[model samples]
Target: MSSLLPRLHALWTKETLALLRDRHGLAALFVMPVIFILVMTMALHDAFMPGASIDVAYAVVDLDNSPQSQALVRRLDKSGSFRRIAVGQDLDAARQGIRENQYALVLGLPAKFGERLLAPAGADGQPTEPLTLLVDPTLNPALQLAFRNQTAAALGTIRADELTRRAGKLFGLPVSPAAERDWPDEIVSIAVQNQRSIRPPSSVQQNVPAWLVFAMFFVVIPIASIFIIERQEGTLQRLRAIGLPFGHILAGKLLPFFVVNQLQAVLMVLVGMFIVPMLGGEALHMPAGRSLIHWWLVAASVSLAAVAFALLVASLTRTSQQAVVVGGVGNILMGAVGGIMVPKFMMPAAMQRLAEWSPMAWGLDGFHTVMLRQGGFDAILPDLLKLLTFAALSLTAAVWLNRSSQP
Candidate 1:
């Protein structure tokens, strides 16, 4: 046991020195993820917010010129979800505005909209001209649907008001035409949790841990580079001559890089907690007490999986260039498939299902369990198990590949 410990210590020292000397690899491991976190958090600041005002602008062409049509427009403006731009009443002008990229949407209220506001189909023996919505082709489909929903909601409120006014007059009940009552149907977002209610996740909350997981996996870059160089230089043969088992060598590489991943975790958390807020982003909130321990457990699990995966890549590739290409592209693919580059919640259902197979996704979900859900160890157990299982499989593959490649 003592002999094994000394041999492992030597291997750890060798890896540490090699990593410190690689300036470019160090930057990729540390600097790149920080920049990604800052830029992505700022860019997506309002996107995760529920009631935040959308920057998209829309215009309306009121062909009816009726009080009801005007009221509908006012209601939409009152929603304050989307910006309203003034455009001429001409339908052609609105269409041209869309073509010229002045606005992304234009709502057209057909003639006699107010007269037919309360009229049912076939009530007047005439067909009612439906509202027409013209949208720019480049606008996001989701935003288009939101606008359509908002417009429909506003129109329904106007119709209800007209119905109440008519019914009040018939029943001799007093009602004020200009006195609008605020409805209780406003949407409020609340995150369900074990403790007190917490705010829904912000951009920084999502970006920091996500990019951090990606950064940790990037240890593959340096790990593969070092492993390939040692193979070419016959360093592995010399270590093997000293009676160091393949397991000890793998163990040596694993600890140093695992430590590297942990250091990365600390740096990323500090950046999220301190640096991000300095740049006008929300400070990242980390779990406290027992929950913090659970968070670390997740981080530890991720480190193991990342280092093992890197070792597997290093073992499989013969040259430094091949290792870099395979490891680099492989990490990117895993990140894209996982929730690292894109939030899983934002992915389509099929894509989210695919993410389940990604090690990065398991790590991310574990962190989210601790940070967002404020979950206990039990809550994060599933994700931890997945990451550990991946690490075990990868390490087994790496050891097998190295043994098979031996002359």
Candidate 2:
């Protein structure tokens, strides 16, 4: 037992020294993720935010020019979410603006919008012309729905105001047009998490963990490089000759890289908390108390999955070049599907379902459960189970592959 410990210690020392010498591998492990986090966080700053001013411009065509029509326009502008651009009153000109890419949407108030302000669509036995929203076909469907919803909200308020004014007059009660000018109808968005209210995750919150998961899986580069080199130089054979089991060799690779992945987690978290905010991005917030422990549990599970997956890649490949190509391409593919390159929330329904199969996705989901949802260990159990199960399976495959390759 004592001899086994000493041998494992020597293997760990050898791995640490080998990794230190691989400058390119070290940079891939650390430098690449920092750049991705900073760039993507700043670029996507407003995307995940609620009530961030949208850059997509829309034009309103007031066909009626009535007080009610003009009032509706004013209400929409006051919402301050979508920018309202001025377009010529001509309907054809508005359509041309959309075609020319001048604006993405145009809201046209139909004639008699004020006269039918209190009328239902067919209450008077004549169908009322509804508001028209002409949109550029290329515009995001989400943005289209947002504008439609904002207009509906504004119209509902207008209808409520007109109803109140008419009811006051009928009851011989004094009412003024200005009385309902500013309705306290603004909706405040609060993200519900852990039975508490907080803002939704900022860009840094997303990019940090996402790119960090991507970076963790990148241990495959260094692991495969070193493994292929050992095999080529007969270092692995020498170790096997000295009575070291394949499990010990795999354990040696796992521990050092596992520690490296944790260092990566700490460094990336510090970058998100301190560095990103300095670069004009929101700082990441971490959970406190037991939630922090849950976060670490997730990080540890991810590290195990990452290192084990690396070992599997190292076992499968025969050369350093093959390792690089295979490991690099594999990490990219995993990141692409795993919500690293693009957020899962933004993915199509089919794509999101596919993400459920990615180990990186499980890790990211675990981190998000703790950090974003303020979840306890119970909340992250499913993802942790997925990652750890993946690690066990990968490590088993790696050991089997190595043993089968032996003469």
Candidate 3:
């Protein structure tokens, strides 16, 4: 046992030294991922940040030119969320702005708008016609809904003030038009209920895990390339002839890389937890009262899958160039299909259904469940099972292929 311990220790030490000495390899394993994360985070910063307001251009066509119509436009502009474009004289001008995607909504005030409002109600004392809000149907649904609600509230307030002014005029009462207005005591109150009592994880929390999976997955090509290069140089056969068991050989090669990958994972988590807050992301929610066991399990499962995939690629490709080409192409294809490049929710239904086939998708889903959903081991069971199955299948195939390639 002591003799084998020295052999294992020597092999591990040698592998670690080789990894440290190869600056290019170390950079690929560590610095490359950080750079990728920074680029992606910067690109998506606006989308993930809270209160990232959009500039929604609104083209108003006020045919009435009445105080009521002008007041409504002023309210929308003063809100600072919607920018009022130059008033379009005709519907064609409004349509042109929408066609150019410069304006998301258009408000057309008819000539009769003020006349109708001042006129007496129907016999039943109800409004004869409702105010019109013309919105671009192609705008984001959430934005459309928000604009609709805002427009509705603004019009309602204006209508109330207009009615109150007319009422005061009728009685010759000394009342301020605003004071006489029957605006609701509470215009709008939002009550947010966090039923879980735990603040949901931010985009960084969800993205860190998903991006880490991608970072690790992409590194598989370079990792396998190292093995393929050693094979081409006849170093692998030399090591085997020196009496290193294939299992020990594999372990020695993978152990240091795995340790490096784990440290990268830790660094990513720390950065996401600390630095992301400065960029307007919220603190990552570490689920209450659980040890680091879950994190370790997740990392282990993902690492095993990554390493097994690398080994499988190395076994399949006879040349290092082929391994690099195949691995690079496969990584990109999988990344695209896996929702790493885009949010799954934005994809079409068929494409979303297809994402399930990519291991990257499964990895992202599992990570999201644990980090974002604050789910426990039970929630990640399916992911764990799928990864284990993939790893086992991949490792088995690699071993069989490697043995068959030998004399």
Q: Which number leads on TM-score?
A: 1
Give lDDT for model 3. 0.72
Residue 241 in model 2: shift from native, Å? 2.0
Name the lDDT of candidate 1: 0.91
Question: lDDT tens digits, residues 1-407, model 2?
Answer: 43888988998999999999999999999999999999999999999898999999999988898878878888898999998888457888999999999999999988899989889989889999989999999998999999999999999989988888889999989998645567788888898887777888888988999999999999999999989889999999998887888888888888999999999999999999999999988888988899889999999999999999999999999988888898899989889998988999999999999999989899999999999898887899999999999999999999899889998
Per-residue lDDT, model 3, residue 358, is 85
Question: TM-scores, in order shown?
Answer: 0.93, 0.85, 0.74
lDDT of 1 by residue, 1-407 (tens): 54777788788999999999999789989999999999999999988888889999999999998778888988998999999987468999899999998899999999999899998878889998899999998999999999999999988888888888878989999988754556665788999988788888899999999999999999999999998898899988987886778888888888999899999999999999999899999999988888889999999999999999999999999898898899999999999999888899999999999999999999999999888988888899999999999999999999899888887
lDDT of each: 0.91, 0.91, 0.72
TM-score of 1: 0.93
**What is the Å distance of residue 60 in model 3 from its true position?**
4.2
Off by over 4 Å in 2: 1-10, 85-103, 110-112, 116-138, 167-173, 178-186, 347-353
| Predicted candidate 3 versus true structure: per-residue lDDT over 287-319, tens digit per residue | 445525666677778777877887888889988
User: Model 3: which ten-residue window has the lowest total lDDT?
Assistant: 186-195
